[model samples]
Target chain A: IAGITQAPTSQILAAGRRMTLRCTQDMRHNAMYWYRQDLGLGLRLIHYSNTAGTTGKGEVPDGYSVSRANTDDFPLTLASAVPSQTSVYFCASSRGTGELFFGEGSRLTVL
Target chain B: GESVGLHLPTLSVQEGDNSIINCAYSNSASDYFIWYKQESGKGPQFIIDIRSNMDKRQGQRVTVLLNKTVKHLSLQIAATQPGDSAVYFCAERATDSWGKFQFGAGTQVVVTP
Candidate 1:
């Protein structure tokens, strides 16, 4: 059903470069989220949107930003990537108070 | 700072034996919890979930136990198989934000045949 689709499954970028991770959900969920996964650390919320046109900061939103202009797409942007930003990024969507459906994930390596 | 954590970083279980993965949450206000299984090179998959009001919930071959009094959660798998090997994570839904969830570090379950 292609519940959620993420682009650039893997990428290697130089530090100080700009990158954007694309996420799209066909489920037509109301809420979308961006999370990063690092070794020894579970998923940490970077940013989230309860609905279209509303974005909120999450636990770790410093090096990241997100926009939810529509219900089907919520993209995460890294203005200037750093070495420490090298981690796997996941996009998730869910209806209110329901289980989340996550994307396959985008693995970005900042060198 | 409230957080969710796992009791063990890794667990090894033999095939056909039952396995239990433990989790602890510091947020007493959390009312809903979920268990997810993540395999290699993939996103976390929903396994089971339990609400704070319920002590235990069972699925086909899995059971989730929630201890709100102690703020602990557990996932039990019966007849463990090699296919069950993966990293399991426990997450708590934020009371303030019904759609927001905080996840634990995770426990790697390795089922030996």
Candidate 2:
């Protein structure tokens, strides 16, 4: 089964440029989340949506925004990319408070 | 204030031997603890989870032990295999936090023949 798919597996962007990372899940889960993984640090929550049309900020939501337009898609956008935003981004989905299923991840590098 | 951390960054075990990974959490209110395995270049997958009310949970060849007394958690894998070579992350969720999991950097496991 195609659990979760993240677009642009890897990307490079110039600082201050706008960018968006796409995420789609076939599980039809009610909740979705975005997290960033950095070296020496654990995965930090960036944003999460409990259901469609609802979004909430996470621990490190600064410089990042996420939207759950429908049950299947939740895209993360960066208004202005910065060097500190360079990291592996992961998308995950879950049903209610159940376990989370994660995507392969999108490696982003800002120069 | 809550934090989850792994004791060792890397662990090497011989094939067929049992391997144990340790984790520590500072949140006494954590209701659930989870272990996730991430293969190279892949997203983290659930291995097992233990609730605070329970001290241990078992799955396939994996066993998760939670010691709330010491705020410690451990994952034991029976008969280590090459497929078990991956990074293992420990996560904790406090009571009232739905999906807000506090994660650790992860421990890398290497199984050798």
Candidate 3:
């Protein structure tokens, strides 16, 4: 059903470069989220959107930004990628209040 | 910030045996808790969930127990198989918050055949 899909399965970026990770859902969910997973650590929220055009900062949102122009798409951007930002990024979406459906993931490596 | 963490970082169990993974949460106001399983290179997948109003919930061969008094949560997998070997995480969502989920450090399960 292609519940969720993320582009650029993996990428390597030079330090200080800008990059955007794409996320999309076909379930028409109203809520979308961005999280990063590091070794020995749990998934930390980066940014989330409860609905289109609305965004909120999460637990770790200092170096990341997200935009939800519509219900089907939410994109996360890294203005200046750094080595610390190298981690596996995940995108998730949920219908009003149900369980969240996550995308495969995007592996980002900053060098 | 509220914190959720797992008591054990790794667990090893023999096939056909039951395995239990534990998680402790610090937020007393959290109303909904969920368990997710993540394979080597994939996103977290939902396994089971329980709400504050309930103490236990079961799905397939998995069961989730919630102890609000101690703010502890656990996931029990029956008849552990090799496929069940993966990292498990517990996440909590506040009752009034939308799209906000706090995840605990995961416990990696290894099944020996």
Give per-residue CA lDDT, model 1, range B1-113, as digits (tens).
99885354889999999999999999999999999999999999999998888999999899999998899999999999999999999999867877989999999999988
Cα lDDT tens digits for candidate 1, A1-111: 769999889999999999999999999899999999987789999999999999999999998999999999999999999999999999999998889889999999999
Give fnat of each prediction, in order: 0.68, 0.66, 0.62
Every model's TM-score: 0.95, 0.95, 0.95
Clashing pairs in 1: none
Best by TM-score: 1
DockQ for all models: 0.59, 0.59, 0.57
lDDT of 2 by residue, A1-111 (tens): 779999999999999999999999999899999999986798999999999999999999999998888999999999999999999999999888767889999999999
Residue A30 of model 1 has an lDDT of: 96
Model 3 global lDDT (CA atoms, 0 to 1): 0.92
B3-66 in candidate 3: lDDT tens per residue?
Answer: 8753547899999999999999999989999999999899899999899999999999999999
State the local distance difference test value for candidate 1.
Answer: 0.94
DockQ score, prediction 1:
0.59
Pick the DockQ winner. Answer: 1
The candidate 1 chain A region of ten consecutive residues with least summed lDDT is: A1-10
Return the TM-score for candidate 3, rounded to 2 decimals: 0.95
